[model samples]
Target: MRTSYKNITGLGSAHKGVGHFIKQRVSAIALLILVPLFLFQFLASFTTGYSGVMAWLGSPFGAAVTFLIVSAMVVHMRLGLQIAIEDYFGGAIRTVALLLNSFIALMLWLIALYALIKISFGG
Candidate 1:
């Protein structure tokens, strides 16, 4: 059997929306784990200078973690912005918001991927 709950707009079940929230929360937790590591790395970069920083990033393990952290960040941003758009914007604004979100997400992914590769491949 199936049941439905009326949203404020009274259109469909609310359960569909829960995954969005869950995904966002998962990303948030991931970020919480990454933030300290990222900050510490950034601080170390300053201490060690460019060559040292690049050397650290150039490591296989460093490259892998960087890729994972950046990818998760982009996914997190998408979910958050999607929720905001759907919550407040309507009609054309919502469409525009979605387009912008997609663009930003892709940009982040590309930049992060490039950085990860450069770090992994030695330059």
Candidate 2:
């Protein structure tokens, strides 16, 4: 009886509980570690100018770090925005907002990855 009601309404359940929360927290942790590494490299790149910056990005280690930073950053952004949209919006608006949030995050990640790969390969 109780189980049937829960299945019908999709409420009073612990199914998939805190999965999104855990993911967001994990991504935040990754960014906390990666941001300082990025800042240090970025700041030092300023001294050497454009070519130097490109060179750093072109290297394997630099490219990998930058990739990780961008990946984590985008995931965190998407998760955060998703929570906001889900909390504030409803019905069609919530659906649309969620879709847009995902699309924007995907685009940002793709653009950054493309540029990073291009620079790494001297293109």
Q: Which tens-of-lDDT digit does each residue in 3-115 have in candidate 1?
A: 54555544456546567777888989999988788777768776888887787788776666677788789989898889889999999989999999989998989988988
- Candidate number achieving the greatest TM-score relative to the actual structure: 2
Residue 29 of model 1, lDDT score: 94
At residue 6, candidate 2 shows an lDDT of 51
Query: What lDDT would each prediction earn against the true structure?
Result: 0.81, 0.90
Give candidate 1's TM-score.
0.78
Report residue 1 deviation for candidate 1 (angstroms). 9.2
Residue 68, model 2: lDDT of 97
